[model samples]
Target: MAVDLPGGVFRMGSDTHYPEERPSHRVRVGAFSIDETAVTNTDFAAFVADTGHVTVAEQPLDPAQFPDAPPENLVPGSMVFTPTRGPVDLRHLSQWWRWKPGACWRHPRGPRSSIEGLEDHPVVHVAHADALAYAAWAGAALPTEAEWEYASRGGLDGATYTWGDEPRPGGRIMANTWDGPDFPWRSTGESGFLRTAPVGSFPPNGYGLHDMAGNVWEWTDDWWTSRHPDDATSACCAPDDPRGGDLEASYDPAQPQFRVGRKVIKGGSHLCADSYCLRYRPAARRPQPVDTGMSHVGFRCVRRPATVEGTP
Candidate 1:
C-alpha cells in the first residue's frame, strides 16, 4: 500500500546538526504517493521472479575495475555489520563492518543465511541500481531527496524525528534504532528488533507511513552534496522541487581516481545508536555509492500524479 502526501512548504535541513545539513532552508514539493513502508523482501522477490532480474551483490566483481587488487579479494560481496566483543575505537567504522562474500538479499548473512522468516522485513543489500530497476518494474520512481525529507517530516516541519522532537518520547521507543550501549551491541528491545525489523513494526507517522525513521537506510534519486543551498530570504526566492548535486560533485573525495558517483540515502538504519550515530531524524542524509550495496541499506518507491496531454 501507498500513502498520498499533501505537499506544501516545509523547512529542510538543520543548522545545529552535521555540517552537511547546515543552513536550514525551506522547500516546496508537489503532491505524490509513496510506499507505506520500505520495499519488503516478498515484494522484491516477486519482482525478481517476474522479471528474472539479478542484484549487483549476486554478480562477481569486474577484475578490470580493480586491476591492482588481489584475486582472492575480487569476489561478489556486500558490507555486513559484525558486532565486536567489547567497545572499540568509535572513529574506526571497520571495527564492525565486514565485507562478506555471497551476502546478497537472498543470503543476508552470507551464503548460508536465508530469508525464510524475513519475508515481511524490508529487503536489504540492494544497490542503487537494483533499487532503480525494481522501481521501474513496479511503474514507480525513486523519490527525490526533497520529496523524501518532506514525507519523512510527516507534516511536522523542523521536528527532530518523524513522530516528534523527542526520539523516545515518554520512555517509549518509536523506531528500531540501536538502543543500548555501543560496546556489545545490545538492543533495548523497545522496537523488538536488533537489525532490520519488519516494516510497520512501529506506529505510523502523521502521513500514515511507517518505518520512516529507522529500519534501513533508503536510497533517493538525488546525488550527494556537501551542503544544501542557503534558505531564501523571501518567498519569491524560495526553490521549488529542487534536485541535488551533479555527478562529478558526488564522487568520494577519498578516492578521486574512482569515478563512480554517489547518490543520496535518507533515513538512518537500526544500527544508528545515540552513543554514536544520531541520524534517525527527518533531515538526516547520507551518501552511498551507486554500485555498492550493504546489509543495512534498502529502498522504497514513489508515484507522481498523472498529467494529461495538454495539461501543464
Candidate 2:
C-alpha cells in the first residue's frame, strides 16, 4: 500500500546537530507515491518464492569484487551485531559488528537466528541489491533520498522527527530504540521493542506512514553527498525516479573522521541511543556501503502515487 505525496520543496536537513544534517536546505520533489511502511518479511518472501531470488549475502562473493580478499575468505555472508551482555567500549563499533557467512535477510542475526515469528517485521540483513530486487518485483521503486526525507518529514516543515520536533513529548517514547543502558543494560522495551519490531508497530507519521524514523535504517536510492550548506545545492534537475548527486570529499562535521563517501541511510534503529547513536531525528543520516547489509538495515518504496489528475 502506498500513499500519494503531492511533492513540493521542503527543508531536507537539520543544523542543530550532526554535520551531515547541517546547512539544512530546500529541495523540491515531484509528486510520487511511497510505501506506507518499510518492506516486510512477508513482502520479501513473496518475491523470493516468485523469482527464486538469491540475495548477495546468500551467494558466495563474486571473485571480481573480493579480488584482494583470500578466495577462502569469500563466502555468502552478511554483517551480524554481537550484543554485549554488559557495558563495553562504544568507541569502536566494529567490536560489535562481525561478518558472518550465510547471513542474509532470511537468516538475520546470523546462521542460528531466524525470522520464525517475525514474518511481519521489516526485513533486515538486506543490502542495496536485495532491496532493488524486491522493489523491481513489486513494480515499485526505492525512494530517492529526497523522496524518503520529504515523506518522512510528514508535511512538517523543518521538524526534527517525522511526527514533530519533539521526539518524546511528555516523556513518552514513540519509536523503537534502545531505552536502557544500551550496551550494558537490557532493552526495557519502553518504546515497545528491544530489537526490530513488526512494521507499523509504532505511531504513524502525519502521512500515515509507519516505522519512518526507527525500527531499522531504511535505504535510499540517492548517492552520498555533503551536508555542508556551502557544498549543498538545489537538485539542478527533477527527474522521475531521481537519484542524488555523487559523494564529495565532505566530512560529517560532527565526526570528520567518519567522512562522507558512504551512501546515506535513514531511519535510525533500535541500536540508536542518546548516549551513543543520537540519530533518531529525520534529518540524521549515516553513510552505508552499497554492497553491505546488516541486521539493522531495511528499506521502503516510493512511486508517483496513483490518484486523480494533479493528485500525487
Task: Report every candidate's CA lDDT.
Answer: 0.91, 0.80
**What TM value does model 1 have?**
0.97
Task: Count the clashes in each prediction.
Answer: 0, 4
lDDT of 2 by residue, 107-191 (tens): 8977887889999999988888889889888888888887888888899988878888786977877788878666534666677
Per-residue CA lDDT of candidate 1, range 27-97, in tens? 99999999999999999999999999999999889999999989998988899999887778888989889
TM-score of each: 0.97, 0.86
Runs of candidate 2 with Cα error greater than 4 angstroms are 67-72, 228-243, 247-261, 305-312
In terms of TM-score, which candidate is strongest?
Answer: 1
- Name the weakest run of 10 consecutive residues (lDDT summed) in model 1: 182-191
lDDT of 2: 0.80
Looking at model 2, the pairs that clash are 32-304, 33-303, 33-305, 87-184
